[model samples]
Target: MLHLGKPLVVAIDGPSGSGKSSVSREVARRLGLAYLDTGAMYRALTWHCVSHRIALDDAVAVEAASRALDLELSLSPDQEYVRVAGQDVTDDIREPAISSAVSAVATTLGARTQLVRRQQETIVRAGRRIVVEGRDITTVVAPAAEVRLLLTASEEARMARRGIQLGGSQSQEQLAVQVLHRDAKDSTVVEFQRAADGVLTVDSSHMDFEQTVMAVVHAVLDAVGGHRKNG
Candidate 1:
């Protein structure tokens, strides 16, 4: 694999259904870097709380759960897994039930603090050469990253993409709850709708998947210099 001589931390932040997860994973694969889906960490935490019947509104309980979260997730673009307390929750965390409750856990201030620390530690463990994507990655988790990007799309486009992503199972109302409402709740804590200073924004409202990916890749190359070679 090709490698940059120095650490190349690519931090990407965006709202729900904004293609942050898929695009960041592909960007990491293309750049030969590790991938960290910080949002999944929140989802996993939500799943844990729901499984244990912990009240999502109970901030103290949620924060305690965050600090004690025994979460193991895949850090590679090629593999996809999330194990919470040795239980494989890769598919469990993506359920609609978890989606509806994730923002509750994510927006808890104390919980966010604990998770952000874990995410930062994960970056250091990866030698700071990873593509991290989430709601607050660019601004909070890795503000000093070499490349900071905000991948976004129009709400309609985002909902459409999310519907397709979920295999057309969710109704329009369900999509609105999952995509728009969740964004609204999460935004109370993280400013992901607007790009922060020095953060590049790529609006994929009218762009296809390949086009959007190339746009992000171009932005990375422009910011960091040179195209990454494929292995």
Candidate 2:
């Protein structure tokens, strides 16, 4: 449904475990657009700080590290990965330790500034035709995107999905900290729990991944019609 001549930029925001990452990636793949995971950028910074033994609570040090962090991220949804300083931390970033500490880095104001600037640069690199998802993408990062969406799910649904991803090994309490607690922490810096004006909201609480993907794709087509108009 995309107009090849005028590439579309889709900005999606959602809480953790709402399926935004998986859904946005699939939508980008279907539309042949680049994908950006802003949350992973924060996670990469967290991984870097942790590797260097930088305390998460040290705001000044974390902000300095954010500016100097060397990160390489893949835009292909099919081959998504993150590398920091030539070291592959793709799998390491998803470990429970990183998940538990990522919000600390994400909540840092100066850190967010650095990452957001890089995100804007990335969007430009994509020719403004990309599917970017994260806490503040629809509002703060790309408020003027061609298509803006906020994906959400009930707490029960979100926890269930994340629990399955964790092989049901994490206790309900552990999952709560990872999902609810993390969202609460990140929400302070970015208002992603609700849809902003001009942003479409998709509740994936009941729908499967394919259904959610279609919902987002429909949002994009609805925004600019099936074709770009002649200037």
Candidate 3:
């Protein structure tokens, strides 16, 4: 069972195309902890927008819709998925249209606040033993987390990984440009920047997905210690 006040919160934060989501999920599985893909929240919001024919740039409307979102973020031993108001938005969120626009959807204050509150509520309610993957969880949502790791990869390497994940023959350069631009936006947005201190930054540039997961999991567990210390 997931324990509260569980002492260890593995907050895996990184840029868009970095190995944050996949590796963090794997790490949580091996450790038998809950995993949350916050980026998928944004993607699902993007899907909501697409479904409603809303203007992607309108932050007020987006935030309103976000507050009304009946969203669920779920993790099991075998798979991860997200549903908005009981409908699966998993595949819909990964569409190129949604991928290109989620940053705008996520960058707003309303969106961030909504998600951050949900994030904090979930972690604390779950007793703090979870692996949360996102751009801002370490710096913003889970700053008090016992263990925070920044997973980063070289631009080329990240692009290659994204291309593989997105589809074959897609433009890595274009995706890289978008990812870098999103990074710049996220880090420089004055309020939503990186955590200044106490973040274990791990470079997954040269590591395979499993290798990266193992390294990060080792570091997080090493810091927190098993068998429930502070919880």
The CA lDDT of each predicted structure is 0.92, 0.91, 0.77
lDDT by residue (tens digit), candidate 3, 123-189: 8766677888887777778888888888888878878888888776567556865677767776654
Candidate 1's C-alpha runs over 4 A off are 1-5, 227-231
The backbone clash count of each candidate, in order, is 0, 0, 2
Instruction: Estimate, for each residue in 1-231, the C-alpha lDDT of model 2 and write its tens digit.
Output: 566758578999999899989899999998888999998999999999999999999999999999999999999888978999988988999999999999999999999999999999999998988999998998889988999999999999999999999998899999999999999999888899898888888998999988888888777877878643232
- Worst-scoring 10-residue span by lDDT in model 1: 222-231
Model 1, range 1-231, lDDT digits (tens) per residue?
Answer: 235657999999988888989998998898889999998999999999999999999999999999999999999999999999999999999999999999999999999999999999999999998999998888899999999998999999999999999999999999999999999988888899999999998999999888888888888887877755452
Residue-pair clash count for candidate 2:
0
The deviation in Å at residue 82 for candidate 3 is 1.3
Q: TM-score for every candidate vs. truth?
A: 0.96, 0.96, 0.89
Candidate whose lDDT is highest? 1
Model 3 scores a TM of 0.89
Pairs that clash in candidate 3: 4-127, 5-127
Each model's Cα RMSD: 2.2, 3.3, 3.8
